[model samples]
Target: MQIIQSLSEISGRYRALFVDLWGCVHDGVHPFPGAVEALKAYRATGGKVVLVTNSPRPRDGVAEQIAGIGVPADAYDAIATSGDSARLAMYQGAVGTRVWHMGYADESDDGFFTPPAILDDPLAIERVPLERAEGIVCTGPADPYADPSEMRPQFLAAKTRGLKLLCANPDIVVDRGGRREWCAGAYAQLYTEMGGESLYFGKPHPPIYDLARRRLAAIADVGDASILAIGDGPQTDAAGAMGEDLDLLFISGGLGAEETGTAIGGSPDPARLERYLAETGVAPTYVIGTLR
Candidate 1:
């Protein structure tokens, strides 16, 4: 993979960009000014920008959350979220009607329960207790800071009942302002390891990529060859892009900063980056320290 300093160096090669949200455009708590500017600049060149995120929040919720953190609307043309894709599946009876909801009780994840507007005759879902439910819908753990092993007992019960879990976000963990926290994928991984079935609709999975393509199609008729997938997650973004046969620009400074020896606003150590990529078995088209 070729290492570049800025996106402008290769921006002319693609017609659209499938940019990741967390760890690319924002740090969850705030926006990355350079990333935001880079997106705006790309859009100015008549290129489409689709914010493909694994956030469990719906599209509108994600838009609001990013706006609250200073990520302007002009940076991207559209958004496609894993929550929306999973919601569509849930409403289509991927999971049974009576489902057990596993997430924060503070109502921060309330938007996940909303039905997608595209579904005309959506299933009538009911949130019942785990023992009485037919399936489970997981947005994330009730406490992101806690270990996923703590859910073993609950996962065992669900497995015994043969309940299927619909995972909204497939991100194992994300750095929110430099503080790493667990995500829904970690819970799903643990559940699956315990013999429970977990269905994912996020990055590294085909469902979310389909949704992102539809979002891009609504704006312009762009093909897979003209799209560049950009993100920091090797397992999610890199894997997803490879699966879809799209060119990828891997940002080594996000999750791989420590392993790549990349300082803030600085490029990664060439030797370290090569070693890291070799270990992950991911080959991206380009590499950048940050989105800018």
Candidate 2:
């Protein structure tokens, strides 16, 4: 038999929590109702919480953004970000190298100093060239790079030069506004499909989970079966929890934005909810409209 419980009851079972950052803790625009309160209460009761995110931003940068939006830095035990994983991949290589970042280039990469010859040019494979590149950092929307048939011309320029692809965000798709976007993952997937090697990090992968696990070990380590991971998106979050072997709680409004309309007294109608489920094929352990 299945049972439903409130936020407190859900979090009560685990001594340590590995929470997804954007959807579970706060919406992109603001903090979700009861998230902060529930977290503070959980920590006060000696439960450990760690904020795990795939924002492509460094952990410190993510922390600052969370602080700007009001999730206390102390509320969570540790942060592990995709950017940090990307940096780790680079660090695995020799220093003072040119790694063409073919994704969303954050201002942090350029501001404080020069780190790896970071470039955001999608066409750099032809113009600037990747032959001399120490490695290739892929995190770009490939559709804009051109149709799949045009892949060889764009990236073969890099491969012709023997460039390795380092995938920062291993997410195949991300919900942007309300649509599923083709990110760097699509490109990396294509590269490997064509027999090119790639290093993957972030959701639905093991590296990010191992990192989060090591961090969780210091503060707390609850059995995986007892830990619940609440998230909004299925492709990344729900699938990620399944990949990590943890329980899942799905939020309906964030990445599942298609159902935000036609409120049934202020929430998505059941028909719309069914539509989203049918469309995404995401089955969560718990389905909730909001944190409150």
Candidate topping TM-score: 1
lDDT values, one for every candidate: 0.93, 0.65
Q: Give the TM-scores of the predictions, in the order they appear.
A: 0.98, 0.76
C-alpha-based local distance difference test score of model 1: 0.93
| lDDT digits (tens) for residues 106-201 of candidate 2 | 334421122323334212122134555666776555353344345666577766656778777766655543345666677888877766677777
Candidate 1 residue lDDT tens string, 1-292: 8999999999999999999999998898988759999999999999999999999889999999999999999999999999999999999999899999988656566477777788899889999999999999999889889999998988899999999999999999999999999999999999899999999999999999999999999999999999999999999999999999999999998999999999989999999999999999789999999999
Query: What is the total number of backbone clashes in candidate 1?
Result: 0
Candidate 1 lands at a TM-score of 0.98
Best by lDDT: 1
Clashes of each: 0, 1
Task: In candidate 2, list every pair of residues with a backbone clash.
Answer: 103-139
lDDT of 1 at 204: 92
